[model samples]
Target: MRAIFAALLGLTTGMAMAEMKTEKVEYRDGDTVLEGYYAYDDAAYKGEKRPAILIVHDWNGLDGYEERRARELAALGYAAFAVDIYGKGVRPTNNAESGAQAGKYRADIDLFRSRLNAGLEALKARPGVDPARIGAIGYCFGGGGVLELLRSGAAVKAAVTFHGSLATPRPADAANIKAKILIQHASQDPSVPLTQLGDFIKEMGDAKVDYRMIMYNLAVHPFTVPGPQYNEVADKRSWAAMKEFFLENL
Candidate 1:
């Protein structure tokens, strides 16, 4: 009986894993070939459309971290796509490379938005995705990308950023945002000063935008990232907040 029970448990676990589908998707931004990670629950996608979420990667590009997040979202019954901003095979292996690659896009918001929109288009075109109920989330550099996507007047219903930049070259463009926004930040983050948060709040307010900002005290930069800087309490709280935000808006 013990052996039989163990066999049944293994089968169940295997079946559960089989229900979730994940793949590497090759896409494009103009002539640039971008590879993104797509994941969804096959059992939930049986000829039915579901809300989708676009995930923007950090400066390191499309790596395991983003893929894990995509799978987590897929488990939550939403189709998740982790986009590539550095083009195919352009992942940065070190801080210097990451800074340069991320900085290049930061210096040119137009180029950044264009790449982001291309990812959005790819997400919309995926099977079993409801284009109208789409949302976006970003981390670090990707968090800034999500904000840019919202500012670009994309049809996304919601946007969420974790430790992303609040400064934009065109603050006046906030008037173009059509989605509700959520900003999750580390209060002690030296990279993003409190003044920047104040300015961002003013920008959103001036545009009469619907948005909310949450600050996690004692947390430094990349609090959500799993490492020495990771704050367990803040990470859990921020993720829960994001889940609620997407549920309410998307």
Candidate 2:
């Protein structure tokens, strides 16, 4: 089913663009110090506090792909922070290392949430950011992290997930969620089966959550990435959907 969905969405539009400037920013997560890349439109000058979006990376942690997404958001006139989840400049190149790092973070959900929250704080502290109007988006593992933030009752205007897992061990309080959510899923994704998808949708419905789940018939895992796994059409459409969603919600 996921494969089928990927295929269907594969025939859509092409990619879009905007130039970006990248810089490193630091923040503290309790005793641990972390760093991330801040990408914004080159057109942005000093003293311009624009709306911002936090971009979370996959299990591989901070990498060029995530940075590109941040640039894309910046091009759209939003200050985008591509956060690092695995400390400063520590990106795993292989799947094994990525899984190991992800495992350590998942083993302690509180710590994981704290790290993400710290990143959020860092973004808010930026000179041009409007602390009251922030949003988040993540890919793969980061997608799940963004959802966890929403589940934790973080005060944000919007959240978006691309090919992320939908199920969580602990259910979130419906009343606590303040952000509108948009989830893009690959219909035939083996990682998230049909049963899990149905259960997730049911839970959201029962909670009366305001959300939209877009299943791309022809896209698969890592559909939005720019590498070999990327599907140009799906990436473009999903991003368009996200841009529209954020514009309306945030």
Candidate 3:
């Protein structure tokens, strides 16, 4: 996914880049101002409709990591949008703060879905975007947020969760899910217990939702990021799986 894009969405008011445009955008969910980053190769898909991706950031909220992924997607010929779940200027500086802000959304599933759905709206509104061929990917806290989006039936073609929380207050809401789901888990991760994963599997089965779950050996929480347990192999394989899944479905 890391190839140079020919054109980006353009950075703030258009940079006139001949290749790859990255831009910061301001959107809203209720009165909360949300800032997001988006990237696309307008020229790559010129006059041709293409799929789009919506990203929910990790617990720390919108940051460079998510935007970097957007560029990667743009390189692969997809419009990618990194949504702000914690609102503009609300990025968490530490794990404690990250947990607190993410907890707020977790505690209120409706709010979490509302904010994430707003991000989806932003993605769908982009020029040349195919509203029917949209997908979402999230990491950590954002991982759970994407599940919330599916539970709320946001109409995405697919959803991916990387080391995301499996417990949900409304497991029965899985009945409303329409998108295919992929869950990437770390085998040795301490944060998300096997028990939660089991319940999630049962929930998805009970709802008859299309889904796939993968557990990587010797990996742990935040395995895809810069962390003690980061497994390059696992990260690459998981991303490949996601890309393939989206290709088949979207």
Candidate achieving the largest lDDT: 1
Ranking by lDDT: 1, 3, 2
lDDT of 2 by residue, 1-250 (tens): 9998886666442222234668999888977779898988755544666889998889988988887888778878899998888998677989999999988877777777888888998999887788788999998889988887777787789999999977776665555678899999987678788888887888788788899989898788888876877888888899999999989987
Q: Work out the TM-score per prediction.
A: 0.93, 0.87, 0.91
Alpha-carbon RMSD, each predicted model: 3.4, 9.7, 5.8
Could you give candidate 3's per-residue lDDT for residues 49-132 as a string of tens digits? 889999989988899899898999888888999999988899889989998998899899889999999999988888889999
User: Model 1 off-target regions past 4 Å?
Assistant: 1-18
- lDDT values for all models: 0.93, 0.84, 0.89
lDDT for residue 63 in candidate 2, whole number 0-100: 81
Residue 165, model 1: lDDT of 85
**Per-structure clash totals for the candidates:** 0, 16, 8
Candidate 2, residue 78: lDDT: 90
TM-score of 3: 0.91
lDDT of 1 at 123: 97
C-alpha lDDT of candidate 2 relative to the true structure: 0.84
Q: Which residue pairs overlap in candidate 3's backbone?
A: 6-19, 6-20, 7-20, 7-21, 8-20, 8-21, 9-21, 10-21
